[model samples]
Target: MHRDFAFIQTAPDRVFIGWGPFEQSPMRKPGRPAFYIADFFLDDPHPWRHPAEWEELTFDALADRAGDAPAPKIEWERMTLADFQPIFDSARAAMRRGDFNKIVPVQFENGHLVERTDLWPWLFRRLAQLPSGMSAYGYSYQNHGLAGATPEMLFASDGRGYRTMALAGTRPADRASELLRDPKELREHRMVVDDIIRRLAPFGNIEVETIRILELPGIAHLATPIRFEEIGIERMSFVEMVRRLHPTAALGMSPRTEAGERWLREADRGVKRRTHGAPFGLEVADHRALALVAIRNVQWHGDAIRVGAGAGLLPESQLEREFDELREKREQVKALLGLRASVAIEA
Candidate 1:
């Protein structure tokens, strides 16, 4: 099916689906809903789109429509440490040069579909199985698309107030305890939390909740919930809000400056991340939106499939460990997609 669609699970039972023929808009229509689709850099000038049709459906019904179907098999070329080394080295060197306090580098696995098969049903089936606390998101157009459940919500706003979280510092489920006390992980997580607060300082008085562990099937992350309820004199548009907080230290770099942003945009040149870590959100009503970070997703164009995993890097970051983390993330994503079984990490 050559269809264009976008969706996000607003609640455990309520999933909002929007399908195109979408009309691109410079500004969101009053009282109507729209989807804010953008790349990692928010490069799309007109990211707002009014879908042709939309509905809020139960998560169970959404999965039932797809029915029971087997996913297509494909030959996959997994990335090796050697393939990720150059990217990690570059990020680490940049940190040592005082260019950044933290930087995130991504690794990708490429594959080709072996036979003609419909991916939507398989994807929906997998998404329906996602655990609680994770929001499922997907977007597709023509022959290219992406879908997966994200553990991190970029932010959600009801016009006057907002809720977001700083999610970083990954560890295997077996080593979850290590994340609580590891200095390297703590420092990395702190950088993400502090940067988020600093950026939202002008918005209003912010409150940060106690740190907690967000556990998935095989991996876990340090998560800190944040609230931005009090508003200042200036009102920010959904697009502007996305621009301000996107690519937070968790996905981008610390001390987000114009120069640092430009550097990140150009890092690992030629690897255009169309939606990975991008803001993929749905505006449910006037001044209400749920934005999700597009991580842990599988992107496909025709027969070519791409899966990516990124890790935050610090000066003390070791290549071997970083590579292992990347592998762990990719495997977890694969498990989420029903591409493979969860691989447990030895403590």
Candidate 2:
């Protein structure tokens, strides 16, 4: 019997799925790389189950379970820092101009290869091999593939209630364990938590925890989890909450729309790469849509890899520190791709 295979494509209605070849990175020959399906999404009955389920199915186990599944086609391309610097600079300048606090800039490359059928399962197997501290999410859009292990909560809703957290501010530490002791970093994180609570006030009774330390693979982040209980309104769906909470101050400045526009305009003019304008894949449902901030992500196209990294810029933000932050974020992508050094930036 012929096996079934599908490629995630965006429709006119704005529905799409994006997967990177993360799991397959280590297996690919040097110079001829492959993209693991990092993210997968579909409207209504999501095509793939929760990421937890995917995690439980390992690569060897999956091969045994579905030996008949078809292979997926791969595409590849390279992204350079020379191409990204102007976009970063523009976002920084926009912050200086007070357009908004920060806006994430992203880029993608098309991987030009195709492998076995049954793409998601194969992709999931690869991701499952990663360390547990990594948070994996599946979205219903073809936005792009993200790799950064961020501690910020973009938006999450559990059918009845909705909650989101802001995670901004940064300090470099030689060890991830030191994040808990950094008072200055904690202060920056607090600013985000305080603002998110204020924004969710109209929805219902909201409770925010005090700042605490959260750790990912190579970094530690100041985290504050906020919870909300639905009040007068009927049970709120995930899409509804995302509409209100997405592009939060963590990704853009307060009054996000204005900040986004300024960064978009500047990035469009300064950067030679493509900017999809808005987040790519947006799935709306009566229940929920887990929207992830497309940060520290990269796109695979044939032999080339395009890595996206940006930092929050405040009036007090230093260019050198911001540069360091970008470097830290790029480290994983470099390691995954087996690249020794990252492309340097003039900024």
Query: Per-residue lDDT tens digits of candidate 1, residues 1-347?
Result: 45688888898878998889998977788877998888787767788888999988987787897676786776777566678787888787777778887888776877778775778888887787789878898878888888878999989884578888999999998989889999999989999899889888876878899999888888999999998865666556677778778888999888786656766777747578778999988885656778999999988988888788898888899999999998888888888888653222222
Ten contiguous residues minimizing lDDT sum, candidate 2: 6-15
Q: Candidate 2 — which residues are off by over 4 angstroms?
A: 1-60, 63-96, 101-126, 137-152, 171-173, 177-184, 255-260, 268-289, 334-347
Question: What TM-score, computed on C-alpha atoms, does each candidate reach?
Answer: 0.94, 0.61
What's model 1's overall lDDT? 0.83
Overall lDDT per candidate, in order of appearance: 0.83, 0.45
Q: Give the runs in model 1 whose Cα sits over 4 Å from its true position.
A: 232-235, 341-347
Give per-residue CA lDDT, model 2, range 1-347, as digits (tens). Answer: 12222121122112122233222221222332121222211112222222111122333443355443333333333444565566567666766777765455544433332442223443434333444424333322232322232234455555567556666655443465565665545555665666677667887888787766555544556667788777876866434554466455555455455556556545545433332211222232333334444454444333333555546555565556566676666555444333333333332
lDDT score, candidate 1, position 51 = 91
- Ten residues in a row with the worst lDDT in model 1? 338-347
Clashes of 1: 0
Query: In terms of lDDT, which candidate is strongest?
Result: 1
For model 2, state the Cα shift of residue 209 in Å. Answer: 1.1
